[model samples]
Target: MSGSQMGGAGWEKLRADIQKSQFVLVGEDHGIAQIPLFTAAVAREFKPAIFVAEVDPYVAQAVAQLVAQPGPATAYLRRYPEALCFFDWSEEFELVRTLRAQQVQLLGLDQVFITTSAPFYAQLAGLVKGKVAKSYFQRQANKYQAQNQAFEKAGNDDFAMAKQPQSAIDSLGLLTQQEGPAAQKMAHDYALSYTIYQKQAHQLRVNLMKQNLVQALLPYQTATGPAAPKMLFKFGSNHLARGLSQSVKGEFYDIGNVVQNLADIQGQKSLHLYIIGKQGERAESDNPNFPAKRVGTYTVAENPELLPFLSQVAGPAWSAFDLRPLRRALTTSKLQLANPSLERTILG
Candidate 1:
């Protein structure tokens, strides 16, 4: 544990730890711009082969395209404000750009991708062979296009499509089967992720997401097997933990479990970091109009209880505390802050 101003010592240790590892799970308060700014800084420092995010694969692709497009970011915002609206955080625009600019391959670990990017599934209708499967996706594509129009016309309530049917799922399987090798790429691509979304509708969401992570990361494995492609997985802490979560209401195996397994294979280290906002004037965090560049930071007298525990952190309001030492010594360091507002508790 150290002060937020531990300076070079903090980053030296943090980067050293990251260098000795295969996957880093960075848990953050949802919609906090500060976290993403810190994340961009981490990515700049670590330069991992892949940056895994708790984002839709389609949205990631869209942002990449927008970045490469001849127009400004606002063009993207106007056409697909839903992407930013989904997270309700404008600052993520920087994270997307940072990762893309760094040439770090972006992988969206979430399995659910439906409705929001219908054009993807719709276009898949043209790519896949076979009449029956093609017809099924074609119909779905048209329906999704109509839904998009209606959503825009009705002021984009932000919810466009839902409830993929068994028939649609079955048809998608057949479509992928018909497409063969091409379908494999499509299945993992923006369009086919919806099929995954539909499939994971009932399963523990993190399970499929971990599976997706495994598939994307397998290529980075080396012959020596001690080191694989380094990765940073950022998501809500709930989605990164393992074992049974009574709150989530099921037996859950998340990214933490996935990384542990990866460590077992590569013989590397893995960590499960839980972030909590402690002792600050916490307001509602997910503001669409908040600074798009970074989460705003303000000064506060560091609390005595926290001062002794947290190491140097980057964000203005929150500091990065190395909890690994504490995890080894204490069985639990329950971080539910005493001040409720500072916690930035979110419900999804």
Candidate 2:
């Protein structure tokens, strides 16, 4: 995993933390190629029993099964186009393959991606026994085909699931009300995701994520069983902050906060790490309809607070800064910053 961009010092620090912590969360910028390699390395060192990611639960199940098969990644994608999320990126696919190859369990606890609607509708149509319900699902799938086309041309979320008419949502709810447990759960989560997106309800979304996390851990928490399973989480930076997450207008407790608190309750430790490129290219878009194209560049130097870390980054290779020293200094009142904003960003 030398290509991971992490230097020797970074790996040493990471190994030490992984040894001490029951939970490790890696908060990252989404599109970098090196982050996946770095993540794969961390998975090797941590050997987590569960790896939580930022995709839907159903998508996670499909990915786990897909990588275990003996075939090219593209073949699985071609067979179930638009059925998977982040794995469409080759780097991301390799990361999942590495984790699954190590026999690690994966749990996805984020809202369904934008590409999820049509294939999901098609699957539901195939599963439902009622002719009326099947027809409704089929029609919805066809409608999404048109919506996707228009979305591509417009490059807007006007066709997002959150914008679906209320009557259509009510109809969908009615059809799945009496289905089996799996179908009902999918339908319920699907609708709730839509509501969360429409309202921009960060707290509600994090609540659902926490609920999923708890549900995933329940089996490992039995009184007669061994200690709670070791876990590693990968998500966008904002979702994994140790305290109240930073946002445009407000702050809220996120999954990182929950994981840290969970570790505390279990009489163990959790390590939170944030990673980003000092200056490099990032994917132009997250649109799953097409192959990811890297079209833009970003520099962390734009933010003065990030400059301290970016200045230490050498060349194109990955560098890691141990924030523990800075955190400790702040706690002891040995470090003081004239910029209140910088202090908040670092302390958080």
Candidate 3:
């Protein structure tokens, strides 16, 4: 309650590192209210030119437009409750509004959500020429509506896009061929994402995300190969680790590692922080319709190196542990630790 969103030496240390780092990445657990609060504080301090989000590219575009005017966003959510994924949370909405107000570029680089198909199709419909094509897009939009509704009611893939007929998919692909470049790109990404989901292709999904990050930054690059705009990436912990992701058993280098390499090319550093609740009741289910059914305790300080930071988590305030020094200690062999695996987790 007293610090910079929870003040003390730890917060000061983290802020100092943030001041100097070109990229500040926050890997967080979903369904925590304090996360948005703390992240907003980081936004103010970092003043990043770009804010990378966890949602899909089109959804990010929608969020940027919706948050520009607060009242319409609320109304739109009421009608299409799951139109946006992570930002559907009230706290996340406020955080996006904060970033929008600061004039930060919001970039979403992930797979499209099932419930957002209707809105995405509507966007595609608006971009194309001619009445017949427009009508076709509208019909697809309606199908998406029906599919989403059925999936929500039964919570099954039986009614999902993955099960759609091959002919239907071919028709859409053919329609996109007739559309403009912008519409074509959207359809291509969506189709690739659909295939990934259908096959449960985790590596392909990660590769797509890396490609999206490159595509999002292309405009800023030139013949001279200048650095990308200063950015703050907010994603799940698994997606933001430096080298190997625990989720993938050390097989994949995710978006966080991608950003790190980019920063290294520019002779700058990317700061990655993993944030979670000290202890609290968390949402049992991501769906808003699912009632809060249980209380849980979450913490990331079980390791001895993290114990100092744990003590800084005072009532109603958060804590920040600057892992850079600990990371340095490991690389330089300043601290004697016998376990190699524990060293990697701490370094991460």
- With a 3 Å backbone cut-off (N, CA, C), the pairs that clash in candidate 2 are 5-318
Each prediction's whole-model lDDT (CA) = 0.57, 0.75, 0.75
Tens digits of per-residue lDDT, candidate 3, 1-348, equal 332264667788888888999999999877777778888888888999999988898889888888888554666655454677878776787788888889998998898775676777778889888677788888887787776666555534333466666676566678878778888887787787777777888889899899999988888887867579889999988788787763525577899889989988778989888986666755444344334332345655433444545666677655555666788997898987665545555677
Per-residue lDDT of candidate 2, residues 65-111 (tens digit): 77787654675444444447777677887788788888888889987
TM-score to true structure, per model: 0.68, 0.88, 0.86
Per residue, candidate 1 scores C-alpha lDDT tens digits across 173-281 of: 6568757676556654543455455455435465667667767766666776645677777887666653332133455566766677777877777655555554343
Q: What ranges in model 2 sit over 4 Å off?
A: 4-7, 70-83, 149-163, 224-226, 287-294, 338-341
Error of 1 at 259 (Å): 0.8
Lowest lDDT sum, 10 consecutive residues, model 3, at 286-295
Deviation in angstroms for 135 in model 2? Answer: 2.7
Residue 124 of candidate 1: its Cα lDDT? 71
Off-target runs (Cα >4 Å) in candidate 3 are 1-4, 150-159, 248-250, 284-286, 292-317, 332-342
What's the true lDDT of residue 228 in model 2?
70
Model 1 collision count: 3
Which is the winner by TM-score between candidate 1 and candidate 2?
2
